[model samples]
Target: MAAVAVNSPPGHADPPPEGRKRPPGRRRIIPWAVLALWIAVLAAAVPLAGQLEDAQRDESVSYLPDSADSTRVVRLQEALPGGEATELLIVFSRDGGLTDADRRAAAERVAAIAGAHDPAGGAPRGVPSEDGGTELYPLTLTGLDEEEQAAAVEDVRALAAEGLPEGLTAQVGGPGALQYDQEEVFGSVDATLMLATVAVVAILLILTYRSPVLWLLPLLSVGVATVCAQAVVYALVQAFDLTVTTMAASVMTVLIFGAGTDYALLLVARYREELRRHPHPLDAMLRALRGCGPALLASSGTVAAGLICLLAADDNSASGLGPVGAVGILCSLLVMTTLLPALLVMCGRRVFWPLIPAHGSEPRAGRGWFGRMGASVSRRPVAILAGGVVLLGALSLGALALPGQLKSEDSFRDTPESVQAMERLTDAFPERNAQPILVMARDAAVPEVVAAAESTAGVADAEPARSGGGWTEIAVHATDPPESEGEEAAIEALRDRLAAVPGADAAVGGPTAQQMDLGETSRNDRMLVIPLVLGVVLLILIALLRGALAPAILLAAVVASWGAALGLAGLVFGPVLGLEGLDPSVPLLTFVFGVALGVDYGIFLMHRMREEALGGLPTRQAALTALRTTGGVIASAGLVLAATFTVLMTLPVVTLTEIGFVVAVGVLLDTFLVRTYIVTAASWLLGRRVWWPGPLSRRPEPAETSPAPAAGDGR
Candidate 1:
């Protein structure tokens, strides 16, 4: 009989005994069949995935809360004459105050634009600033679709640039310009995010596996998952009219690579271990799946569940992210489990290259860094626990410094042309709201609505801009700057007074109104989605761990880490990075990701500990054993996940950058500090009680003979 492998070195797979191989039958055919099935599926999915960009709905109404006044206004406006008009403000300015030449030149440029484009109203006239240094031309370009509107804006900008007199700078600003910039950014997002994410994942995989050939398997599987996810999302959008935002699409990629690679890491590590015991690669893979499959399913399910809770959000953007993100995670889980295993089996033992797990060999025991750390932690459990708490608490204090909701102008890392134009408008029109307040009223109540708006305290002017489909559009200018406290108060007052008009179902909307709605909806979403995510995650943990105490401990540690991460972000975002304020959605996003992903490491640790305890080791010994054996893989997974999120920092959008930084930081903290020290110490201190209410929580029967092997022994 051939000797069975006890513990093999890393990456060296043992060959089967001579004349001892089992008959080759359906097993060999099965792997190639699975691989062929995936190849066919990938081919069919590529075309559908290519169409995903066409399904994106990035308009303001697409993101607004359904119950918000801005949303109502948008719906009503679409029913009006020529649909919603694209409004633009053209500003021509000179530093030393406008000369007669600059004024004449500005008028000529305005007339030139009027001639080239069909204006909704008559020819636009230049309205000079109070200081006489700037002239503004308000143009309403109506009766055009999205593409035509973009073309009109581009043409206007071109004319302004070409016709501007020397020393008089001109820019196109307003709703239309901002919308164009947003579209431009989103249009390129898929390519930029995909490329960066792929690069990051590939680098991490190469480093983690340290094999020229092994890293490609997971990356290829993840690629298949990504395309499949996109195809699914595309179908959802086409069939159900789902809203897909740039933020949601970008985040989907991050989740796929981060969560998918994490599962791959756990599976690969288990497969490597199994290789030492089972001579045939196929047998080893089966054993690996049996061991790690449940953990991967639970972890992915937890993340998907937490993300699905976003459907409760009032904001369309937030709600859309729920299903979109869930699909990505589920697809990744599907591909990684099925396709990855098949590929690994077919590739054979040599896929591991330099560090193959040869059968009948034992790994050196009790000498790894994780084992030493575990021993030290077991000796000073109380001290480690207290220190971890203090460290997390200290980091969390930074949350107090986090800035308020970010403004539109500060949305990007680098200022785009639209932002620059808006700034110029701000400087020239400090007393007047460059962006008009849009009010939709019943057509019958137009006179009353116009009168009330003009009589309002903060009203600079009110005019009936358009009327159709039983709705009258009133353009009102506030006396205060856009998004200022005074402007917000005015908007509220307008809504209040307009609501009182008989037969008028009026709704107030504009740039400022949208901001108000966004802020309110974000706050409401946090209240709703945060609890839902927590409940979902807690339930998943309980199911996976099959006990109460261990799940609770894991939950507590993860929640603390999330808070600490946010606090840390607050410090860096505002004080250090000099950002204006955080995006309102950042807190909720960070919470969901930090808790869901952070808990993953906890699951990896506690699951292994439970396994050790079940195998008859004492509670303290089990905890230490689990940590020593699983620590390296957990650390590697953490780094890979963190690196993927950090890729988001390369984007110009401030929101993505913030999400990336906070999530990446949170994952690292959980892996190194929370999982390595706090969880380990807490488990050691609790002993068997960590699995309370389960059979393992009770004392086991005494061993008949010799003491159990050292915690780090491969056995």
Candidate 2:
């Protein structure tokens, strides 16, 4: 009928106007500019890679004496600056009463190690300070902050290795104490993560694309961006003294590749499509860029916005990831849109190797299950949505038992110097330990409390006025101690000891306790963050979708997915891994990852639904089509990404382990639960009202004729 009309146009219809035109996107100038910027950025970033680590190192300091009053503390403290001491602490215990003989023999050895520059023998020399007990050695380096100090873990380990000479032993802790082991272990890990990530990315890209150039080119562009980003981050760190944590590089890798590759995929797919339609390679590149660029920009904007929300965390550690993550995503976005396009254009169809191009229709048949799944979902919206809600609710219930504690000892592992020292100290001085009972008196009666603190049950000994300021000073010592928890129990006992004293109160202050506080704060933050973020993200959805009901429905689905992820984490890690509970920060972090990332996939799916609606496809057909198209890609991408996170389980550190397991699980659940199962179903179930209250819902005028017709057309 259409062909007959065209041939009979003179009689069948009014003569067409002579001069109509192609779409506005036909202009090639913007794409060329994008290409140039990508190349330029790559050129600029590669040279600055060498200095990134130094720039990234932590620079915080410690607050402790030049050395522990005990010889053991002196040895550990002396490791840093000439006169400065490491913030070293040790613990001690004894079952039999402390005989003078025991104290003297321990004292003699400690005396040699204390303040000894001998660096070579007897009492393993360095700076040291004994905390509240002859049993514990507490030391801190002067003029250093958390980020700036190197833990004198080795000195403590050596002293421990030499033997306690009898019943004496100690445990080393504090910042320098904790970091010493962590830094050593962390160094080995960096190498492994880097190699593994690169190898995996290379192997996957090669296998998927079946082309060396396709694999090599994207990496090259990312490499440039990464190195430059490193340099820039380093410079920024130098200026801001920001202490980059162990995970910074890993984060950067994910952001750069995830965002970068996504853009490349969209562009490449479009390019391939255009090549089939248009004979000229240059024209195809231009067309592909023009068509996909706006979509890519919008997608990137959503991702960047989600990440930036991390800045809401008050903790420097969590807040820092925001800008750090954002930078990498930004760079990835730039390289893909510009340099990647230009490079691909230059390479042209040659980029697709192994199977040389003949004609351009898709190289492989464009068939997918997503459309079918979506259509099915469209058929039964209520059942799917209700099931999803129930699933999320069940999973979230498991999170109730999750605990918040620092588990500092576990985070670092076998490598840190201080941890090794603690092992030795525990062996050498059973009576001495590194833990401290941090006493804080907000009132002016600080002196009396310090004096009376010795009466505390855990007090093997107490020392006052070693460091810091104001209406208060600190008194610390190792526990008189049981054979059990050492300072941990001692600190508790000491807290009870102070209770008898009027106008005085105290809390255990040490790495473990501080971490506990951080965990609690993080949980509270999550509580605040999730609702705030959900509210904000919903508003964004409403603007984009332009409807009252649809946005609310999507938000409901995302919540369900997030809840399920949390419950699933509790099930696996809590029961299977036998973790005391998921790490304190795990729930909040999991929530953030779930809610933010979940919403992104939801938005993408809904956008497709909107597109289908506008095209006049009936609701059910549109959802089925959307599933076949967008759902497949979402699933594929989600699988690969979630798998990458799963690899975190291989790492030795607990913090990373928790992050890895929860996030990987969350992503997997999200793809199936929300992206495919829920959203698809909703689109079908909602139908025209899916566009309700928006201009899209009303029927269009007859003059439109749905443009030139769709794929399976021409009746």
Candidate 3:
């Protein structure tokens, strides 16, 4: 192979011998100063970052809409006589029938729990199943905070299971037990996600860079970004009382690594190219930063803006994710743009090690894979474009198989004790409600509200449970099992009937109602937030690209990619993974990330294409040149980002797993298929029209000339 001079981009020219000297004293001082400043910042940030876990609020109330009826019910319930009670149901069941000894053991265990905890309700009475196969005991432990409630639930479970008969099993269920189980999942989420994400990102980086030292720089910068972002988020929570859930923190962790590393890859690639053009490391790095800096800023801004649109969501978790994610993106941008560049300059060219880019050494030429792909795509642009669109559309048909909102009991990958207990209760008490519907009304109209609730068509029982301040709480049980269609109808009927009571001001809520409210709010949020996210991203692309047609084309490709990702998820989530349904937040969150992140690769490819076009290349040659130059880095970036999200699939929570799966699929599609084939093909076919309304659209192609060697020829 013969080495040839790599083509300089656009107007760039080789530096004169004197101009290729070491950086001046001031220029050298800048990177050192920047490094010192970061060290000081990290010193202060470490302690604050450690406090982030303590600042997180994972309670169900933390995720509910601020003004929803369910949210109000929770607030009022906390004001009752005993603060907020931890309610649990104890179930003792046998496959065939409970013997007299089994019944005695169940009662004795319930009595022990009552004596130990001093439950608010006097003593729990056993409710036997008609088949004599199971018995249930309901109890409430009041005046307990979240920690105390978790402790109480565990204590009750231990007491209830003491010395159970061989054939009989005892399990705890209800709002309190369910909450404790959910808390357990979230308790380890941060550690689990961080470790998995770090491992995944490290492996991908090692593969992408193929240099141990080079991979460490990006990883280190991302780690710095994570700590700084967490510290910032913790401060926000302390000051503004932001709602930070386990989900938000976990997603933010992924974003910092995924998006931050993306910036590093683009900058590094450009730096490698500049190194071949300049003699000094600092000069090469400065040139690299100058070349790709705007694209980096624009791409990061687009992601941040899309995430910021989440502030308009009604669901607390969704809304909280907006700022938390935005903070993470900004922090990542700051670190990559500042700390990473300084580190690379300080480390000098040897960081690339075995494959260092020597000054004036031209790269060898070979038949590159991306170049071949571009050539193939260019040869049949229309056919390729139509085929890609049809293929994505075909994949999107899986959306029809998507199930409804996932039930709380089914939200975990493995059934916890609470869900197991609920399943047993459902089997044993087919006609009885395992959970009560809570109704709150003005104290003055408590009697009338109770009367209306009791007389409702599906009401099995309704009684005033507690009163405090100006409100009274009533417990209503339906005639059907929890979460069943019959039970849902009964709840609606009770609400309707209670609403008709003059001056009652009644609000209906409970475990089932909370799930209902989440689903409805999520549906409404999609309508508002999706459009908002798309608009924000579109505007950013338009501003960055300075073309209506190009931005529209990029947006459309990302949107189609999102649909294809969701459709694929729908197919896998149920038939392959055995999941019952999706979490209400899954679709909207995936769409936000899918579109925002997917567009990044398009930006990389198109920005390069635009550069080539501006440098006097014909449209067809410009498109192919851009693809040949940027394909490797974009593919590497897409893989890194996809793999980081894939780490979430290793988590036990079903919602996180679904989110990871969908986003990973979307990124892979965008990297290999959409950006590589569809976008490039469209550019080749549309020619300069892809940049309509921009100056490039009106400019004539330069006369045919000898093609310069491709930049980073062998990269």
Give the candidate number with the greatest TM-score. 3
- Candidate 1 residues 1-715, lDDT tens each? 0011113222234344454655577669878999999999989999999998878877778878989999989888888878888989888889889999888888888888888887877778888888888888889887888888888888999998785667889889888888888888777778999998999899988887789999999999999999999999999998998999988999999999999998888888777777777877787787678677777888889888988998899989888998999999999999988999999999988898977768765655554777778878977999999999998999899899898878877888888787787787778788888889999999899999999998888879889888887888889999887778898999999999998999998999998899899999999999989998988898898887788889988888988898898988987897777789788888888888888889988887887777666666677876777777788788888999999999888888888889999999999999988999999999989888888887777766334333234423232
Model 2 TM-score, all chains together: 0.77
Per-candidate total of colliding backbone pairs: 18, 85, 0
**lDDT tens per residue, model 2, 1-715:** 0000011111112222244443445434445666676557657655565666545543122111112122223232334243233456544444444455555555555564455423312232232223323355445445544344443355554564355646655455555666665665655666676566566666656754667678787667666666666766666677876555656655666556554654555556556555655555566666656655644555566566666776676544555666676677777777776677777767767777754344434334333355445545655679887887677788888767554353554454234545555554555455544445445553455666676666655566665533333334354766432123455565556556655666654433544334434555576667766677677677777787778677787777766766666666666765676554345556665565556556655665666566655655665565565555555445545655565566566667666677767776777777887768876666656666776788866655223122221221010
Better of 1 and 2 by lDDT: 1
RMSD of each: 3.7, 8.1, 2.5
Q: What is the lDDT of residue 310 in candidate 1?
A: 89
Total clashes in model 1, counting residue pairs 3 or more apart in sequence or in different chains: 18
Q: Give candidate 1's TM-score.
A: 0.94
> Could you estimate the TM-score for every candidate?
0.94, 0.77, 0.96
Per-model lDDT: 0.84, 0.56, 0.86
Which candidate leads in lDDT? 3
In terms of lDDT, which candidate is stronger, 2 or 3? 3
